[model samples]
Target: MKLFFLNVLAILLRYTNASASFQSRCLAFSPESTIFNSTLTAREYVTKGTNLTFPDNDKSCNQPFQVAAANLCRIALHVPTSNRSSITMELWLPEQWESGRVLAAGNGGIDGCIAYDDLAYGTEHGFATVAANNGHNGTSGKAFLNNPDVIIDYAYRSLHTSILQAKKLASLFYGQKYQKSYYIGCSLGGRQGIGAADRYPDDFDGIVAGSPASDFNHLYAWRASFYPITGKNTSADFINAAKWVVIHDEVLRQCDTLDGVKDGIIEDPSLCHFRPEALLCQSGQNTSQCLSSAQVEILNRIYNSPLYGTDGKLIYPAMQPGNELKASTGLYNGLAWPLSQDWYRYVLLNDSTWDASTFNISTAMLADQINPSNIRTFPTTLAPFASVGGKLITFHGGQDQQITSFQGARFYNNLARGMSVSSASLDEFYRFFRISGMFHCGSGPGAWVFGQAGAASAAGIPFEAENNVLAAIVDWVEKGKAPEGILGTKFVDDTVAKGVSFQRRHCRYPFRNTYVSGDAKEPGNWQCRGV
Candidate 1:
């Protein structure tokens, strides 16, 4: 039966000729026969510079091209479920393909669409990139709760189904199975990548998860826990965001030069000790620029320590320096307060009219009963991920304001413990790099934009940080060379004019780049320092 279906699909594909006019459709084939059971249609779209006449011949695979824009094809899949209605998926595939690798990125919020740039880059590299809306689309956090399908999809099913379908589609298009598959994303996408590794270990060979929100239930609870202080307060009145900025500024001010260069980037935020109250506005002055007394206290709580158990042991680490408070909105903030709130109110409580402002943090403990984020409920364990010899590289900006880098560190530690793999042994299968000044999947003022300054200006030269990450992953996968320490480059447009030169170094884990001796502007004078 499968052979018959393949023949039919081949005949159909042969006649189609990969033409621009050919319908970009999704077909549900029988798992055994690969015969079209049903079809989900996709709108014909085009990426910048894509030639429809080329058919499935995507030449961008071997060439370097600047991404001006991306053409996206979105489709919804009704995945079968025993307990819920049906799960819906928002799948994105770049219209052109130059390679066979498929990338699946997870969205941060229930509302925000997929990371378009990430998908564009993947498609440009000849990979089919897929991202899902995680069930429902809404600004409210309570939406997921009322819908059984949404919860199931958000939990794991939707992404898994999407990946399976995407791979099948790729097989049909390329006439060959994907040579290799990879997943790259941050925050929620990070979580999705790890989730894939745990549940469906065979999905991808390489995964780059930046600051994943692994402990979904506990982390959501933590956000609700903070609502008591931050929910009502504006940027001026809120203590959490204000104290975070104060800490961030103080860290940069004191440690900016620690790396032997004061180029405005903090090489390592962990090295800097920050005091929030030190920057408090004088007396009664309260505005967007400064924090008030109440705000400072709240910040202290956020940074000082996590809520502990009866044994006084730590449950979670405090938010690290360099992260912005607002980043939480897109990644952490939206997930915790808005997304989770909407889920709880609408799905579980069936009360769409419930006021979010009235949410009581004191009752947060009850969340476990309503929406359990326990790891046990997850379909897969960390064992299969390591067993299959998969390669996972995760990078998070230390200055991310949303989901904390500490969370990534904590997840790694847990994985290390669960897998019984030594830190060094785990490096063979998984690695995490923390970028000191970057923010949320490589954006924000603190983000290191290597080569951003036209490749000719000293002040705006691109840092080779992100590109190095891409390189390291490729080398690790194809060559079996596990990245020991990644080399980071700092470029200066006018090196001769400034009497300086570009510097490069291998940044190790738990250690940050620091200056050992000599001029601060020079990169060679820096060393990786441990906290």
Candidate 2:
């Protein structure tokens, strides 16, 4: 009996030791050891927590990844004597992995949560992704002034430091140096991607920036200007949400059929020669349903952006027709407006009492005070970005209502100019695709088709029934076969609600998809018309 008991005790001890060994092995990669080159050190790894969540596939209901959430360990590097500070960050690794590559993403506005979809996509592809809150967290515009640290971080340090620390961590964990590095983001993320390529070309190998906010200062100032018009008792108040619906309906009635089918989707908003004044109730007999004169003027300005000269020459394209009302949600209405107001009042004027109403469009030099889109000042020259051999691909929905697709086009054009290259030459390093009929980011009231899953969302636009932009990025980076054109579809099943049925071709830059002489629904009915 004593010998038998001794044997049992030995087995128990062995089992306990094995379990401890497994736990230690899982935590082999520590963030502190991950250093960028030999000069910088990663701050301590901080585990935010973990959760069990379903994978991207349908079986996610049954089998899920042990999702680990962590705050990137960071070193706060002071920028000279300025109030601004930059952060060097190391994304804490999952407990299971010994080593993984790093993906640095950019944040939008004042809120700095790495986009949930982007993060899921990156981690699933076996990358440890990192991003910064860009200093302050509320809304970017107002937060910049209230906290000196926030503005400085957003200005330059956040991107600079994050890259340095991420590289260091990669070396520490893998023992082998990273074979390749990539960057991916849209909108503000797009801006950051460009900034890195132009400013710190050596940081990444491939970058995918969609709808970049290149001119940060000008864009923010423009948002401030629009907020007063959209908010307050000005003409915008008369138009309001209800009027937006009416305008949307009118735009659909006039241009929805331009694509050769009355499928409720506008194949091209640019081709939509819509005039809101046509909807106005004849002369003076006012109806609550029809727009007032002030309302009509406001709609025109909102849709037409700010006029640069007397001839009504456009400085920037206005939000497309169907997108006027949706800006009230997410960062656009909630964060952007309040923050812009705060910046105009507190940061610029140093007087919180100043009313936005007092500012006049014709006389006031708002651009001088708060400019977010000054390319020259914050220019992203391709030389810096190209030297690193980084690849960047950007996509924006042509029908995007929040920030117009023109913004993407303009940035790409500027990039090409800065690089001293033609569109064809840049195609090797960077690419842009304008998804037709899709809304801001990815969600909208259109039938967007991808893979074999017919129409994915109620607001999804149908073209290529299963072509996902995120998936395209993965294919592009891993395979090296650049996407030439993406397929778009139009839905037909639910008559009341549009469904994906017809396919359209989305041509890359310098190549515009033009309708053939006969059939518009047929894919062969369109050809790439190069500029």
Candidate 3:
């Protein structure tokens, strides 16, 4: 009996040791280790959800996250790019890495915070994931002030160096080089992916960029321009939170049923002419239930007017319909969005006291002139991206209050126009998926959850090429199976436990979701059609 118990004990010990069995190899990684030249400054084997600490001042980067990751090797790096500038990055190497694959995440907004969600999202899929603080340690673009190298890092260098370091580290950690490398991010991170495609084409085999705010310099100008148009909260033309609700209801009343169903979502806002005159106050109507003529004019400009530079050139398109309530709460909350404020204040003027009251076309023209490390991700063509055999998938939400989906479509058109190639040829290397009713990266009345960054990661869905966008891109790169569309899930009340409310197969570029038969919620009832 004693001998039998001894054998059982040995088996139990092995089970307990499995997680830390890689410790020796994990601990072997340090700046001094010479297996490869590395800027890997620190290492830690985290367990029990310990918070990764940063310099105390960097509160933005130190937002407590689940570094409680056991069965993983966490690495910190500092890659010096130029005189007096470096990038802070983190890499998480999972033991059960999926088929020697590497995934790197992109940062959002003017953010220098590591995208821990994307990192978690990647690692959850059995990938070795890496993300950088984008050369600083906060959400403020003030880091760009008096720091041109840092600006350069934010522009494109940080992602390049971080990915290079991560790939090498991942290769060394696993005793083999990665078979494939990929990138995942949305918003600013999306811009970073495109920038990488432009400058560092060989860095990633597959990229999933969502709601990319490319043409960022002009986008900043465009974001700031709204403040002057909307006026201050005290202005007579200003639409308050209540009136914005009225506008959203009116929008739904007019455009919601255009897709052959009434689902409270405007699947395609472009088709809706969006007459603000309809919202004009009826006689004896309560002020809360209608807009004044002055307010009606503001709505017209917000939706119908195009932004132009002083040179009479179209700078950016107007805000598309269906995001009014969200806009009321955020950027249109009586002031310019702080991200835009930070851009104009720190990046352009470099004067902390400067206000955006005078943000006219000339001011925007100056922004275009400076361009700042060429951060504007507006590509004349993606020939270089295509020549290197890269596969790029970009998606923008139809209900996105932040960026107009039109810009995302415009980017696709630019790529084809620049290359003088047909959509079919461009479709070979790059594809754009327009997700109906998804706001920004995720959420809205539509099926918005689909393995995207941030909130979408919460679903914890099993990765499959059909269900997940990340897996779709992977299949595209590895198996040469290009995706026609992705299946988006809208959880009941946006909660996974409540069960799914609906599902839709969001179609790719040059195709629109056309309702044919059966049920509106059933994904198969809809088909991707060229309009």
User: Among these predicted structures, which one has the highest TM-score?
Assistant: 3
State the lDDT at 74 in candidate 2: 27
lDDT by residue (248-347, candidate 3, tens digit) is 9998888988888888877777777799899788989887888888888888888998788878887888888888878887767778678888887888
Candidate 1: worst 10 consecutive residues by lDDT?
450-459
Alpha-carbon shift of residue 319 in model 1 (angstroms): 1.9
Over the stretch 49-121, how does candidate 1's per-residue lDDT look in tens digits? 5533312212322223334234544343444443443433434455455456676666664443434445455
How accurate locally is residue 60 in candidate 3, as Cα lDDT from 0 to 100?
Answer: 65
lDDT of 1 at 62: 23
Model 3, runs deviating above 4 Å: 1-18, 31-41, 47-57, 67-70
User: Worst 10-residue stretch by lDDT in candidate 2?
Assistant: 450-459
Between the candidate structures 2 and 3, which one is better when assessed by lDDT? 3
Residue 71 lDDT (model 2): 27
- Candidate 3, pairs of clashing residues: 49-68
**Which numbered prediction scores highest in lDDT against the true structure?**
3
